[model samples]
Target: MKKRLVAVAFAASVASSFACAQTPVMFSSINLNAPHDNVVHGVRLAVLHGKVSEVKGVDFSLIGMSESDRTTGANFSIAFGANKINKEMTGVSLGWFNWNTGKATGANLGLANITHDVNGLNWSAVNYSTGTTVADVGLVSLSNKSTVQVGIFNKTKHIDAVQVGLVNCADNGFFKCFPIVNFPK
Candidate 1:
């Protein structure tokens, strides 16, 4: 009887040890007292030569572009924070917008509203352009890329491209870089 009990206890300990080695208890949210209070928050998505239809949400900000492939209609929102969107386009079209919706005012480096890429790229902001647009405004460019600084902007359609900044409106007639709001006084 004593021998049997010892064997069972040893087996149980080994099984528990094996389970611990296979999985980390802290890695799961079960260990957290308050799941919402203790958590890293943000939104992110990356696609290379992929198709993006309708996307809408509230985030600090969002950025998408064509890799060495293509992308399509990618519409989303930047609820209440900083928004930086850029995309490299080649054979696809892009469309999107952002909006800043916070009760506490003062920080205005966010979205109000506007359309991007009414025409294709006009310059490369990441590598060679010295052009600067309103951070809180809506801008559209087919330039090599666009480095828009805002909190949000909604889109109307999906687009495609390779390394696109804003939309590839090399075709659209008047949807250019239009400012959404004026700077501070």
Candidate 2:
């Protein structure tokens, strides 16, 4: 009788642990102008707009806005839409306006790309990074620390690599403002 009671208690404890797990996973979510689940493991489709807490796979928004707290895979906003990752993005972000508040570790391609920290590439008409960027290729690129800046206008407080643009300005470079290329002293 005591053995059976112990077995039941162990099973109950295991079951309660599974029940208390808060991270919900979904295979697919279709959001039509509304918010979906907090966590999605698979594809998330939004017809007009979508708001979520986290996404592991693809998050696509057609003709509207896509907002998420964290994204691991591709985040796309089609037809001149906007993609906003509030916390961190580990993969590519493609849209008209790609905005990442925390950190972006992959490629950000859009008309205007803004991020706090970028580790890979920022390709847009206007690329702006508040913290640092490995590379920024756009018509206008602005960052605190850019390793490589290739654009028409490149401005940064500190650059460790090179800036190749029509007009380049670096505060800590050999030249404060150069016409074609600028590098650190």
Candidate 3:
């Protein structure tokens, strides 16, 4: 708790010191939570107020980084520095939702909570149903005291991994039941 207060105080101090005009912040290196083999190196920093900034020369160093996507295709996932989360710097994570009724799909990524340095992200969404509703797809911190659904659901496929989260549950188009998502014990 003291650390968070300290961080917020530091940020406020730093932000206050900035000129009324916009200024650029430089980051030599940052650890964005991403797949180990698919880790993106060389992050670039951009200037923005309450917006997602860019980190320069960032890309996956090796194919090992992408080893987490068990079944692959064109899916939407982001590669942030190991210290990443919330492009807007909102102290939360970037959330998403994509429901396909035919085949099961899942979400997988490396996550880190800046407040607690809690690094973890894992999820899977498989299959689609008639009226399955999606929720919990928004900015959230793992150390958050309350729980909100991330909307990642599955059809029938159950999955596990070192750094993966699963979602995709049985659905009747209106409501659906998601499976249990367990983190490292």
- Candidate 2 vs candidate 3: the lDDT winner is 2
Instruction: Give me the displacement of residue 144 in model 2, in angstroms.
Output: 1.5
Q: Which stretches of candidate 3 lie over 4 Å from their true place?
A: 1-24, 30-80, 84-135, 138-147, 150-185
| lDDT, candidate 2, 71-149, per-residue tens | 9999878776788899899999988899999988999999999899998999999998999999999999999899999
Using TM-score as the measure, the top candidate is 2
Local accuracy of candidate 1 as per-residue lDDT tens digits, 1-185:
99999999999998898555422111111222111222212222322121222122212222332111112222232232222234322221122322111111111221222213323222111211223221222342222223333222212221122112233231121243223321111
- The clash numbers for all candidates, in the given order, read 46, 0, 46
Number of residue pairs clashing in candidate 3, backbone atoms closer than 3 angstroms, sequence gap of 3 or more or interchain: 46
Weakest 10 consecutive residues, lDDT, candidate 1? 99-108
Predicted model with the maximum lDDT: 2
TM-score of 3: 0.20
TM-score on alpha carbons, each prediction:
0.18, 0.80, 0.20
